[model samples]
Target chain A: MNNETEIRKWLEDVMDPEIPVLSLVDLGVVGDIELKEGSVFVEIRPTFVGCPATTQMKYDIESLLHAKGFDDVHVDISYKSPWNSDMITDKGREALRKFGFAPPPKGNLIDDIDVLEHVECPQCGGTNTELQNPFGPTLCRSIHYCHDCKEAFQQFKPMN
Target chain B: MNKTALKELLFKIADDQLILGHRNSEWTGLGPILEEDIAFSSMAQDKIGHSYAMYQILEELGEGDPDQVAFFRKAEEFHNSQLVELPIGEYSFSLIRHFLYDHSDFLRFDMLRNSSYELLAQVSSKIRSELKYHTMHARTWVKKLGTATDDSISRLQNDLDALMPYALGLFEKSPYEEEIISENIFGGEEELRSRWLELIAPIISKTELVLPDPEGVEPVMGGRIGKHTEYLQPLIDEMTEVMRIDPDAEW
Candidate 1:
């Protein structure tokens, strides 16, 4: 008896395996939900086409929906509209900062090299930070050091 | 489209991505700076994942599974360009190789985005966007290092000279280039190389580094037909060391 809205609420519980602090909903990968006849069709997009977590994410979505009694669940991957870091929700930003990652910038940069140049420390709210590397443990992150806090932090780079 | 030709094209691209991704990953903790470490590692993940997806496409075309095709393949069966398989040397060497490789790769994906093959077109479109950032990253560094100081300029120039021959090997043609072009799967590697030249020349012009005369250097070929440098087999062994230990155990 649960509708698309109800299913969406359930989806918010599906955390990204990589970024454990944020749910797929908050990450903005959960695209559209349609309840057609007895089948529920869910569309999701991966943040990166080569993201290894994508298959796991689709499986998690299916399992969560099936556990909630949606028997005929179909998950489709969408690539028509690209995923950008700006798609990350405000709640996701808070979760990222709480989880020790500097959230992606809200505004899209014309020049992406500027990404590491202006990162503020999530730990001490300090502007005195230097980019340690544009590469990180993960594809979407960069590393930086805060001079004031003396803490090294990972930043979610702004995806184009 | 000829299925064989399409598969041939896809394999080369996938193999290149896989090998380079592994090589780029070797920089994870060894970069001169932490930022560069993270940068190279990020690109490594992207490249490796790209290979995984391409392998999946091959699976759909009736090839083996992605894991088998990637991790289990012998070095001689790999179709990657020789340029990508060379070890990541000094920072200048790596950077120069990165600059040359990414320019051609970005352009290649851009061309494939409009491919007649629907799945390939879709994949290429997504990949092309990601590669845009990669090329931008390469260009920024090449410009910065190419013009920075006498020492920096000379180092980059030396690496650039050393790498150009192998870099030209990126365009080593497929036997089915005619079929590929006829079917519109790709615009052919020769076209991509010409375009890459036009694209890279301007970037080099801004820097102090001199562009090598294409006529002066003979291109290193045969990676497409499986003649790789001696370095590839060892690299592959190292990459698959863990997987080969227990082939069937699930993580």
Candidate 2:
């Protein structure tokens, strides 16, 4: 496997501490990973300026690489370009589904869709949900109450 | 406030943030746990960023570039209150500091959001949005640690006791006190302090932590006039090392 492919696989197992089903890569927080001269440089942006998961994400990345014999790993935190929901990949959406959290609803009329469009439930596949609060498990998510399931789950907000 | 007084007031607000942010950042790699480490580090970064934004406004008013204002100022020339300059004694202590300052800052920025100065008002609005998350992040840890095991609760209490005096320093009235408030440049510092106390009282009560009596504690001074603790020098040195290597280089 190419180095990028190998690192991607290792990163897939690095789950977010708050959201067990979602890995850092899946959340699209891991913006870019470059390996140069046997050293790994990983660029990441937190869900917000003060998201608590940033430190753990760095440590987990370092440890994961170290365990895989890539001893020299560096994690660079950047806030130049803010994080947005569009960054989350297709595979990440699938992972979220498998983990029992609903993936964001499919785009319909992409041009005029509001950023706060309703998120479908991964469990019962219900659209009868409302945001309970903007702040959720982490800074990037919002608390949504599924009217159908009557369950409160954290959903990633589309950062503008 | 006269222009000089306004400049001094801005400096105090800017310098305090710059130094406190630097101290909190030391926890980046060293926090006890992964989740907390990230959280603390991010808070530190936000503080610095807020400082930078404020300093930029100062620069526009011809104070100097943000870097020089942040890095090159003499220790005595810094206006940050004593609270932000103190060491981050322990994780629990740091959390207490965060708890107090985040609430205070939220109120401060909220007041600034309505400043008569349009530029300052816009900047305040942006900073206020970011402060909300900082408050939440700090509140989460404070609640968790305050109600956790016996050891955790005790540590937090002790830290709160030790830091309360310094916390009052954050509201020290600068030379421009009257003019700023009278002109509605920003709200009065005394009022801000009272509101901060009110906001934090419930949180402190919920966490089972003692709310330090604001009346009895004499507010520490001089950070508003650029006087700082011994810890600030090395912090400034390290933070500015890269910028100083080539002052004119684009970061």
Candidate 3:
């Protein structure tokens, strides 16, 4: 139970409430796991400063550990490590695509916001998509239209 | 480490975000287009989130509960600039206001990244990144509409000219400005205003929109000192209506 790798493996089952297909670990928000004395402590980073799902994610983490017979569990929402799209694992990006959302282009957005206009279509894998709105239904998502697929979709926005 | 000075600064910044966020949220389901509906709503969430963080920081400093401070405060108690409290009169006016407001907001937070107040600095750094998207959104629309047609350009220009004095009020000096700067808690409003002007000029220049000459504009002041226009109190009252039903009710 004290195995950090094993604990992270278990965390892969904790899916984001908004995007049920992706796990919190793969989402790159789960920060650290530590077994101190008889308790397990975890740190989770926030993708957006005001992301409402963060609270639900915390609850899900705690519930997952408690069901595993861990009597004492502590989960802290931290800003220390900071979550970025670059941290989203390759497995996570595939999950986003499967979920019909464009994965953010892999780069620090601090250097280029213009990349929003060029997202690949999750459905058709086309680069002719147009960014309809940089803001979306959620804080971390951007609305885009894929001319190839003739459909509107969302992207997990690139952030550094 | 002047707590009074720090709280004063935090209150004003937080108030600005909360007030503007409320205004932004008013566009939910009412935007001219679906994309605009989503943009305003999303930005509203980010701004309110930023204000909530500021309130939390204030709470950690031994103030009232964040909600209490946010919902219960009178209009006079709020330190947000007069610019934010004005009604979202028209889409053009709203767009013009957003352009002017977000530039200053972005620069203020960017400068706050170097604050001697570690927590504020950390929060500022995080908030600044999110604000980049907002500023980007504003700049894109302004440039697009500002040069689109004579009709569009005229509407945006009039609004921009009308809003200039009020926008300048965003940098109204706090009484604690001396201590705030001396303690390195912030780069003062004067410095921020200069930087904001420098940053916004290029964006405005790219568009056909005409920026008002600052020297002739009499800067609207007094919002930072709790004096406000008739527009503000009604806004505070409307926002607090639900919370007033049961102020102590636990969510």
Mark the regions of model 1 whose C-alpha exceeds 4 Å error after superposition: A34-41, A71-76, A90-112, A119-132, A144-154
Query: Tens digits of per-residue lDDT for model 3 on A1-160?
Result: 3577888999999999999999999999999899888799999988888899989999999999999889999998776666778989999999999999988888765557678986898988898889888988889899899898798889998887
lDDT of 3 by residue, B128-169 (tens): 888989999898899999989999999999999899999999
Q: Quick one: how many clashes does candidate 3 have?
A: 0
List, residue by residue over B24-65, the lDDT tens digit for candidate 1.
999989989766777788889899988887898899899998
Say what the interface RMSD of candidate 1 is: 2.4
Worst 10 residues of 2 chain B by lDDT: B1-10
Q: Model 2 off-target regions past 4 Å?
A: A1-160, B249-251
**Could you say which candidate leads in TM-score?**
3
Descending-lDDT candidate ranking: 3, 1, 2
| DockQ values per model | 0.51, 0.07, 0.68
How does each model score on TM-score?
0.88, 0.66, 0.96
Recovered native contacts, candidate 1: 0.63
lDDT value, residue A47 of candidate 2: 60
Query: Each prediction's Cα lDDT score?
Result: 0.88, 0.75, 0.90
- TM-score of every candidate's chain A: 0.94, 0.78, 0.96
Which of 2 and 3 is ahead in lDDT? 3
Q: Which model is ahead, 1 or 2, in terms of TM-score?
A: 1
DockQ of 2: 0.07
